[model samples]
Target: MVNIVENIRKQIDDAVRNSVSKAVEAGELPEFEIEEVTVEIPKEKSHGDFSTNIAMQTARMAKKAPRQIAEIIVKNMDLEGTYIEKVEIAGPGFINFYLNNNWLYDSLKDIQRLREEYGRIDVGGGQKVMVEFVSANPTGPLHMGNARGGALGDCIASVLERAGYDVTREFYVNDAGNQIEKFGISLEARYLQLLKGEDAVEFPEDGYHGEDIIEHMKNYIEEHGDKLLDVDSSERRKALVEYALPKNVERIKKALEEYGVTFDVWFSEQSLYDSGEIEETLEYLKEKGYTREEDGALWFKATLFGAEKDEVIVRNNGVPTYFLADIAYHRNKFLKRNYDRVINLWGADHHGHVFRMKCGVEAFGIDPDKLDIVIFQLVRLYRNGEIARMSKRTGKSISLTDLLEEVGRDAARFFFNTKASGNHLDFDLDLAVKQSNENPVYYVQYAHARICSMLKVLESEGIKVPDVDEVNVSLLDKEEEIELLKKLAQYPEEIRLTAETLEPSRLTRYVYDVAAAFHSFYNACRVKGEEEEIMNARLILVDSTKIVIRNVLELLSINAPDKM
Candidate 1:
């Protein structure tokens, strides 16, 4: 929870403002209300530790050139008892503050003090948040899109939790919709084709064509022994659905669990209809004048919410649409369950549905802004420099199970989240399983493992990791050591940013950067054979780096192996 980086930035911001105030009081510059002072870390080391553009921002108000304003502000600055070692005016009146390495040293102590609690920040203030993702239709096995959504949604929920949110992971089961209806139809046709002849029954064109349907029917006949042969078709289909839907749902649960995703709620869509919530939602929309009955169908006025057209909530047959159930589901999340925020991760195909769903939420008097839907792009699996689609074992499209078996859960989860959700990801099957540094997951885990191995060897030689107070952290002034400390200082701010932007990929990149920094430091600094004081200091640094790497990997639900 101790964010040294943010604390330093805040201190600099206050210092800048205080200097501007002092300049005004000294009659060196005209008095103007400082709206905001922005402090940023310089990209180039020669530029300085921190940079600000306060001079340029105040130039117009002070009626002076920016460089002149910069000189006046710098002249009035009180740098005593602060981390600022010196200040310089760079190109175009940029005020760059070079700081002593005290902040990095303090960050190391903070890491040693906080340990696993290092990267946590109070950004959410414990607001209740529900993240619904990978709500794939339980009609078949999950595919690559579902895999990506699972990784992203789980990591986002973890990031939110670390950012102090009371988070709930949920999966909205589409059990009552047309998809389930088609599922039943597909199962019934498969059952009849298996029990009777394959040519006897005609499969519906819109029914599911996956082999899983046939497999389900086969298992059902093996268990039930043609007991449904004498039953009516509608009743038989209903029975088939009753037997198979839960199995498919359970399979989905198992796959996601194996991929390190567990939901706090497995919300069933049929529960809404069974509890009359869907009807209540429709009635609520109608009472609010957001709906109208036309052509014997109930249509929602989506255009009222800036949509291009109206949408039908119920068909002429009085059957509710999936959109209506979705409204009811979100209403349950907001009104019934009373979550402060509801985040949904949807696939690219649902891009157009995002706006209309927001409209539906607004129709029920809920703030549509509270409903955040992330539409992630498609995933292409590549192997041996070619697009790989089918499973080597099943000869069907790759399922989550197939992916886990091939590249493993860590590789699957890490690779799926290596890119932002909005970008297209081509999962490299070859690199994912590789043990070399070409694989990012392996590279990061190897860094952690390398540290663990080093510590283990030191422990065997009776050179244990020292406490922060036991080491003179001032000795960590090497470039590689400072770089690693900077990366360590960034973990808390990174989590805050990830929570704010709802992008877990930021943490993925941050962890990789940490690994790279640690590798560079290890290559340059010798931790064990140095003098007692310096060795203890570098040992503390190495241990802190190990803790951060393990924390990040654990947050991502990836394994941090102790040995490579």
Candidate 2:
């Protein structure tokens, strides 16, 4: 059974093609024509679930008035045995298809069998994709802000994976940079104070001022006392700086895993320099003519290709800017691996950098479309209506670990899951922690638990559940029953749209929609066995609803508890 959207799109496409053929035969249109089939969801439910502008688009070439052409197209639409209950022409000749109930009822059973495979499509086909996100500088624990990017990247990857894209999740670690240097200097200050028993710790200028830095340094001193203290102050400081990069990275890694993120690749910035790839990429760019030099330093003439100004690749001091390493990282993701698509989930603070990066990629002659960037806006977490002003450098920022504990993983994921990725999100702890229906997480999970409770009770009474293929779905077509079935039927379209837009909120929202429908059905309708056949039919609907609920919850990495 094909999805309703795809099924209808095919028939509409065929109809439009036939309309064009008729016009061409009448010598009113060209022998061959080009047009896009527009199968869009209509804004007004009275119109139809989907509206197509195919007739309007073909009118120009066909030399027919748009409305006149629309009728010709609709007449050719082969709606036999298909779900279409009616097709209407409106708004300068758009074709809208309204589906019937049997199609909706049958969809519920198909979705149940598909479960994990539900809402999935081959929009990405077998194309290889790499999604790099939450790649914060590995110099501290992940802040609540950075954690937002992690959740988004991980969730988007999940969406793409479900859409049949061969997607790889990656984290780019900036381990060999200025931030790491500052991290070490701050830790060394505390280390010296503890080891030499100085009056107090004096943090270096431009160094970390976090309370965690002092604690991390204190731990280092207690374990390995004065090991580098024999060297000059500056030399020992450099040594501490070198050691603390790995130290901070290890801490960041533990926190990310604790926050429920698993990366298939954790790419290091230093590795680019070490493996000669950074130099290699620079030389490649130079050869390709996107470079320049001034004031005894090497620069890239990015402005020649529309950048605000040319950018420095290497300083007079011979150190490459962070920009150089990033160019190399993106090159490896695109040129070396030949991924069908490369997506970077970046924080909005770096929004200004989009042009220069895209310029550099296109300068290489690769398709610019292959590289997509999704920017995550800032997050403000409110506890009792007070704003949380937390930062990694100040140690005042809320850690992802603390968040998981306070709100629990299910709540945090659901809170993050509900909002659009690009919009600034407000995490209201008061609302999220509520145990009753006020909490969206509790509501969805509660629906799952109630169905499980009903199932367990039925099992205890020795009632048998229907197999998906054996489901007498036509028997489940009561008004409330078919309404729930319609929601289940929407899974494929939901997954397809989410994958197409690279937005997981659509999928997340659909989960809540289905849950609400189930809850309403639960309150209004009963499913018990004084009458076995009807009871079995209702059981199939509830069980299928449960499968759809668990499927979406898994995508968000939120659990669907069987019991409240």
Top model by TM-score, which number? 1
lDDT of each: 0.91, 0.78
How many Å off is the CA of 266 in candidate 2?
1.3
Score candidate 1 by lDDT. Answer: 0.91
Candidate topping lDDT:
1
Error of 2 at 557 (Å): 0.6
Q: Which residue pairs come into collision in candidate 1?
A: none
| Per-residue C-alpha lDDT of model 2 across residues 78-112, encoded as one tens digit per residue | 66656678888987888888877777666765676
**Candidate 2: what lDDT?**
0.78
Error of 2 at 388 (Å): 3.0
For model 2, what is the error of residue 344's alpha carbon versus the real structure, in angstroms, after optimal superposition?
A: 0.8
Indicate the residue-level lDDT of 453 in model 2.
91
* TM-score (C-alpha) between model 1 and the true structure: 0.96
* Predicted candidate 1 versus true structure: per-residue lDDT over 1-564, tens digit per residue: 788778878878888888888988889888899888888888999999889999899889999999999998888888877788999998889999998889889889989999999998897998999999999999999999999999999999999999999999999898887888889889988998898898979999999999889989999999998999898988998999999999999999999989999999999889999999998998899888898889999999999998998999999998988888888898999999999999999999999999999998888788999999988999999989999998888888999999999999999999988899999999999999999999999999999999999999999999998878877999899899999998998899898889988888898899999999999999999987799999999999999999999999999999999998
The TM-scores of all predictions, comma-separated, are 0.96, 0.93
